[model samples]
Target: MKKQLLLLVLLFLGSIALLQSQVTGTVTDEDGTPLPGASVVKKGTRVGTTTDFDGKFSIDAIIGDRLTISYIGYQPKEVLINSTIMSITLVSGVQLAEVVITGSRNPNRTATESTVPIDVIDVKQLANAAPQVNLNQILNYVAPSFTSNTQTISDGTDHIDPASLRGLGPDQVLVLINGKRRHTSSLINVNGTFGRGSVGTDLNAIPTAAIQRIEVLRDGAAAQYGSDAIAGVINIILNKNVDELLINVT
Candidate 1:
């Protein structure tokens, strides 16, 4: 009688183990688009697996086990494991506005840490609203303490308006393209409009469409970058992206 009782107990334990089977499922959005990297977890336990590139996931579970699926920007779902194959669709209920940031992230920076102020202008965003495609005119409207005045009567400064900063002459404000010093293409001459006619770069030479962004160091950069930056520094970063090509008409 003792041997028969032990045999019955072993057979009962084996039957319980055989009840559990493998469960597979595919996770998709409401529109049937596969949601790759979605989270899939078995309820009441830590066993879980993320959806593959094809949104397919597999796990070992019994017929009554529960599964929870979750994804970012979508409502989570829960379902009972009734079959070996399952199809889960996450609802599009949760949505938040996108925060667009152009500048680099600096968490611990304080306002008093640096004396010089820098103005960051996103040229790509300005391209749509600007009246003309002139880079010089766009800077005058967006950046503070900077101006590009067109001299209707001046000699060489006629077509190419000079750029100035902090009420200083164009020569006093150093211009840099991609961190390298950009020398003045020609002299202002006659001590006219923007300084003693020694050095001045042509702002009109750089195409506005090719520029990505501009960083203007407000004032007092001469101590670090020499007399060229006595008023400030204007760094023009051109677009080095390999995605698009630009064509001009006349």
Candidate 2:
């Protein structure tokens, strides 16, 4: 009878211990404000949860469970949970140096060929750059060599700034989006139908949000991108693996 009573006592203690093993913590930004909807995930695993409105979250785990916290516009953080902490702070994200596309026509060109002088901009930079509705706004401060000249015609319609590729005229340069040719908007307003309003990728139509990176030859390129590539070549790479939900409004 004593043995039976001892066994029951042990089983009850085991149940209580199991219930106490869950891990929990609160997540906040650098400013100490609660970050609702921030994702907390296990390192290298799909198991994860989002913080509640109160910035609180809980998950079942054992000792040494690695956790990763991530949110938009913030640097992702990782923590190893050996003990319980009431709150975790996440830092703001900064742009790290990235491999920019360069010198494709001559595959032999070394990585340091900034001599060609291409201005490559990433989509994420657009948020901080705060560009206007048209591509002209984004390019205005990008390159000193290129100038954007917009003039209003007799009608209320505003004229687009001609993309001057080293003053070589728009027809000489080739504009490609993801290697595909985009139709010209109207005639190259500068050169007439033959040149057609400097027809190239309507940088506006491609949506800067969808761009991953841009590669500009900055030098003459007739062999690789083809005949129209006299002035220079501007190639826009689209983001294939990006989530559609990452849209931002200026």
Candidate 3:
């Protein structure tokens, strides 16, 4: 009886060893280039491995088990492990084109190619986070270096608040609307305010409803633009792709 029990135990161990098998695979892109660092994971389990420098990976898996292969910028692929070796070709994901014009002279230049730091705020972001309808107030909260203060009764300056960038005077910062030079407000801040003795642009003059996106170039562009861009340049791009006339009361 003891010998019979030993034989049954050996058969069970052999069956278990046969159930678990080693799986090897090579991951490649659509162009047939080896994609190193690709992840290969068994479905619904923690068993996984990554491709080596040659885009080859090996992991323990059973037959009929599913394997998921994934890589950055590529579409994920899944296959059933019918064999020990697998050759996977991952397709590329769809990429969207971006438009950037703040720091680059070329209109077709992307934001990643710009040497200067740039911040782009869309209309939705501006209006969603703004507590007040004033553009200066919205920029003060959104922009890093922009600042503005409300004047109670400081002549015409109360109506037209002055805004500064990078802790510099208001006149030091240049403002552009739709790529055109926007004129500064006639009211100069002569009172004791944040930007005293500086005439700044009346950003409130342009309704936030009309704006599409605001691009702020944080680097000095005196050589490219002019001396007016000593502090930085704030370019307000208007929406030209409006198919329907939408108006916001507030």
Identify the candidate with maximal TM-score. Answer: 3
RMSD of each: 14.5, 19.7, 13.5
Poorest 10 consecutive residues of model 3 by lDDT?
103-112
Question: In order, what lDDT does every prediction score?
Answer: 0.81, 0.68, 0.84
Model 2 clashing residue pairs (backbone): 187-196, 187-197, 188-196, 188-197, 188-198, 189-197
In model 2, the runs with Cα more than 4 Å from the true position are 1-118, 130-133, 154-160, 190-201
Superior by TM-score: candidate 1 or candidate 2: 1
**Candidate 1: residue 207 lDDT (0-100):** 88
**Where is model 1 more than 4 Å wrong at Cα?**
1-115, 247-250
**Candidate 1 C-alpha lDDT tens digits along 1-250:** 9999999999998877757677999999989999999999999999999999999999888888899999998988899988889999999878667868774323222123455667777888887776657878888887768888777677777776777898887788898999999878665545356665656788778887788888888786888899989889989999998589886442
Task: Tell me the TM-score of model 2.
Answer: 0.46
lDDT computed for candidate 3: 0.84
Question: Residue 198 lDDT in model 3?
Answer: 79
Q: After best superposition, candidate 3 residue 29: deviation in angstroms?
A: 37
lDDT of 3 by residue, 1-250 (tens): 9999999999999888868879898999988999999999999999999999999999999888999999988888899988888899999975659756663333432255568767787766757667768788878877777887878778777788888788888888899998899998887787687677878888889888778888888678889888888888999998786777877766
Total clashing residue pairs per candidate?
0, 6, 0
Kindly report which residue pairs in candidate 3 clash with one another.
Answer: none
